[model samples]
Target chain A: MEPPRALLFDVFGTCVDWRSSIIREGEALGRRLGLGTVDWAAVADAWRALYQPQMETVRSGARPWVTLDVLHREALDRVLADAGLQGVPESDRADFTLAWHRLDPWPDTVAGLHRLGQRFVVAPNSNGHIALMVNLSKRAGLRWDAILGAELARAYKPQPEVYLRGVEALGLVPSQVMMVAAHNVDLVAAAACGLRTAFVPRPTEHGAGQTTDLRPARPVDVVATDLGDLAGQLGA
Target chain B: MEPPRALLFDVFGTCVDWRSSIIREGEALGRRLGLGTVDWAAVADAWRALYQPQMETVRSGARPWVTLDVLHREALDRVLADAGLQGVPESDRADFTLAWHRLDPWPDTVAGLHRLGQRFVVAPNSNGHIALMVNLSKRAGLRWDAILGAELARAYKPQPEVYLRGVEALGLVPSQVMMVAAHNVDLVAAAACGLRTAFVPRPTEHGAGQTTDLRPARPVDVVATDLGDLAGQLGA
Candidate 1:
């Protein structure tokens, strides 16, 4: 197989452990607000669950455009109410919403990406808007050649344009670019758009025993254990 | 004065020594074509001279929008004919055009940007499109937080949207972003859009004895010798 010229990444579960980071940030927010003994992990999981449905509103044209940060804020409000964690201060709620921007990288992410960047042009094909991506990269030390994804496409992933715009930003054809993600479904969507695909399994992406995306559910160009392994496979 | 959240750069002469690099690349192309001893410096100067008028056509709507790469190619064709250096091979001309992507950074660029990145998000606000910016950053070892500018705005600089879109990409208010440019005229446009401005004059940008942009042509928020000096003044 021909090596891809640019590698577009799925940020949340693939590059960073979003579930764990969200739970940690939720716990910290709980501590700071003196809201003792809340179910932070459950809240995190609920919030993650809401990701698609909220985005679907925008995708289906039921709602007007809003940045991912805005969507996360709305989801956070619903999650907090569902968890019966009432009276969360507005400023505290806002701070908690920004936790998404502070997600921690998986152990091998930084080194592996720097290695891959030496060869393939690398950028995030995330649900993240450019500002969110920039702030997240700064906080997490995930160096990127550019920030692209939902914001650039004005549409979410699994939509063809997201994958296409990611390739366009790199000034390469879809065949010349690869989409790397922890989710097999993302790879499926990318493959449909003619992008090369790399699947890196993060079995514990949702606090272990994550049933979905345990393996490549469909054909992919490359499959590796994690980003570092993928980088090794790519000869980066 | 309050330091800005992001620093947007003017790339060509400000960050990289385009004149010498273009001359060198031209010389190499001339030698490879068995047309040695061609006046490379003159060619470089003539090429640089066409920059503004070429962009002005697009800005004036006399021509449809094209990426800077396309504009550069057209300018190259004209400069070659004007210099009586016609009949260059297509592949060689194409390769020579890509010399823009391989331009070398000034001595203090990388280090100064690294220092600046420690405190603020830094990205180019040049007219170069995404691919050109990406290749140039990779080649020059520039660690930009995100790529932004002409392509993002779909318009060239001195256009209000170009400066506005750059600030928007960082999720920053215009007041919270500073335009750091070697040319004061660039700062003037940026400042008109309510962005803070910093001036770092490159007296030798157009080869020694260059007359234009030799000083801050108008009032600016800060003035420094080079990027390092600017970073120092910003306390980065």
Candidate 2:
């Protein structure tokens, strides 16, 4: 098969260690507010757990298209209320919502991206909106050619429009673009849309006990242990 | 005034030397196709001359939204017909349309963007769509955080939606985002939308004998000689 002309990435668990980053942010906020012995890890999990259900609201047309920031804020409020922290200062809550914008990349993300970017156009085609992606890239040193995905399509992942529009935005046919994602479901969805796919597992994306997405649920064009391995396999 | 949080750039003549780049592409195409003694500079000017009128059709709702690529191709066909080069092969014509994608950046563009991006979110807020901007940025070594502007708004420059949506995409208020352009009218429109404005004159943008946009027609927050000066003045 001909090599893909561009690589579209899945940001959260794929490029960034979002779970760890969110926990770190939560713990730091807890310390700043002198809220003793908060289980930020559990809070992080709770916040992330709402991601899909929230997106489903829009994907299913139950709600209008809103930015990931808006969804994130809404999710954060629910998470806080569930944790009995509804009394937290609005300023701190706002900062915590932005913590998603400050995720740290997996160890190989930056270097691998730089290497792959030398060969193919590389960008995040994730659920995050432009501002969130920009802030995340700046903090993580992820060099993207463009931010393409949910915001551009006004639809969430698993929706064909998100992947199709992203491929079109790069001036390439779906067949000429490769979707690089850790989630088997994301790659599966992209493959269905006629794009190539790469699976790079992040075994501990949801912490060491994470069992889901430890392996690709189906075959992909390339499978590797990490971004660096994927880059090497792609000859980038 | 508080400093701007993001810097939105006007591409084409503002960041890349479009006139020279088009001339170069045209001349090279002419040579490869055995067409001799063509005045490529005139062709470049003619092609650019159609830019405003084409975008105006969309801006005025006389036509629906289309990518700049489509507008450029239509303009190119007209220019070719007028130049008595309508006999050019379809393949060559298609390639010529993509010449806009390979524009060379002004001498200071790369370094200036590098310096400025160290401090602020720097992105192209141009009439070009995402694919066009991505290709141009790659070819020009312009490191943009997020490709914003016309594509995002589905409207061209000088339109309020173009500037306002670009600012909103970055999660910044109009006052916290600065629109930098070589064109007086572009800056004026952006300023009217409540965005801060910086004018960096491109005296030779339309060629040595050109007279338009040599100076700001109205007051702007900052005026500089070029991108480098803009960066320095912005303390980036």
Candidate 3:
């Protein structure tokens, strides 16, 4: 197959270990607030669990377009209340919500992206807004040629427009762009929109014993153990 | 003075030498097409001279929003007719329109941007679309945190929404973002919208006889000779 001209990434899990990063940030915030023995890992998982349902509100056209930042904040409020931390101060809670923008890259993410970027135009096809993507890239040293995703399309992932709009934004046809993700469903959505697909499994994205997306559920154009392996496979 | 959190640049004359680059590309195309002794610089100047009028049609609501690519192509057709080169093939004309995406950066552009990016978010707030901005950045090795400009707002520079939307995209208040440009009018429009402004004069932007925008028309937050000087003044 001809190599893709550009690669659009599903950032949250594919490029970053959000669970560990969120938990770590939460623990630090907990220490600063002297909230002893908070279960940040559970909190992290709970917060992440709300992502799909939150975005579905927009995807389903039940609500007007709102940025991922708004969705994240709304979800944080629900997650905090569910975890019995509703007493968290407004300022601290707001600050903590930005943990999503401070996620650390997976071990091989930076180097592999740098390599892949040399051969292809790379950008995040994330649900995150431009500001969130910019901050996350700055924090993780993840360079992108552009930030093309939900915010640009004003719609969430798995929606056909999200994939198609990103392809068009790069002045490329769907087949000339590859969607790189850890989530099989995202690849399936992208493929349905006519983009090439690559799966780089992040087995522990949901922490140990994670069952979902540990492997590609269906055949994709490329699949590898991680970003570095994927980069090598693509001759980057 | 408080430093700005992000810098939004006007790409055409501020960061890249569009005149010489377009001329060079035109001459090379002329050579390949066996069109000898063509005054490429005149053609380049004529093409650029049409930019504002073309965009004005959109800004005045006389036309619906379209990318700079469309405007450039439309202007290129007029320019070729005016220059007596209307016989150029459609394929060649389409390829030639992308010359905007391959402009060479000013001597200090890449290094200055590298240094400035270390301290503040750097992005293009030009009228160019994301694909144009991305291709230009990649070709010039001019890195950007995001591509925020005309296409994002569906409006061209000097339009209030263009500056406002770029500031919003970076999650920055207008005062916290600096609009850097070689054109006095661009900075004036940005300043009118409450953004900080910087002037870096490109004295030869229109070639040796260029008389406009050789200096800032009014007081701005900072005035520098070029990108390197601007970087140093901004403490980047």
Clashing pairs in 2: none
What's the lDDT for residue B84 in model 3? 91
Docking band of candidate 3: high
Greater TM-score among 1 and 3 belongs to: 3
The number of clashing residue pairs in each candidate reads 0, 0, 0
Of 1 and 2, the candidate ranking higher by lDDT: 2
Off by over 4 Å in 1: none
**True-vs-predicted CA distance for residue B227, candidate 2, Å:** 0.9
* Chain B TM-score list for all models: 0.98, 0.99, 0.98
lDDT of 2 at A61: 99
Model 3 pairs whose backbones collide: none
Error of 3 at B46 (Å): 0.8
Task: List lDDT for all candidates, in order.
Answer: 0.90, 0.93, 0.92
lDDT accuracy of residue B208 in candidate 3: 99
lDDT of 3 by residue, B1-236 (tens): 89999999999999999999999999999998998789999999999999999999999999999988899999999999998997899999999999999999999999999999999999999999999999999988999999999888999889999999989888889999999999999999999999999999999999998899988898899998888889899988
- In model 3, the Cα lDDT at residue A3 comes to 92
Q: How accurate locally is residue A180 in candidate 2, as Cα lDDT from 0 to 100?
A: 97
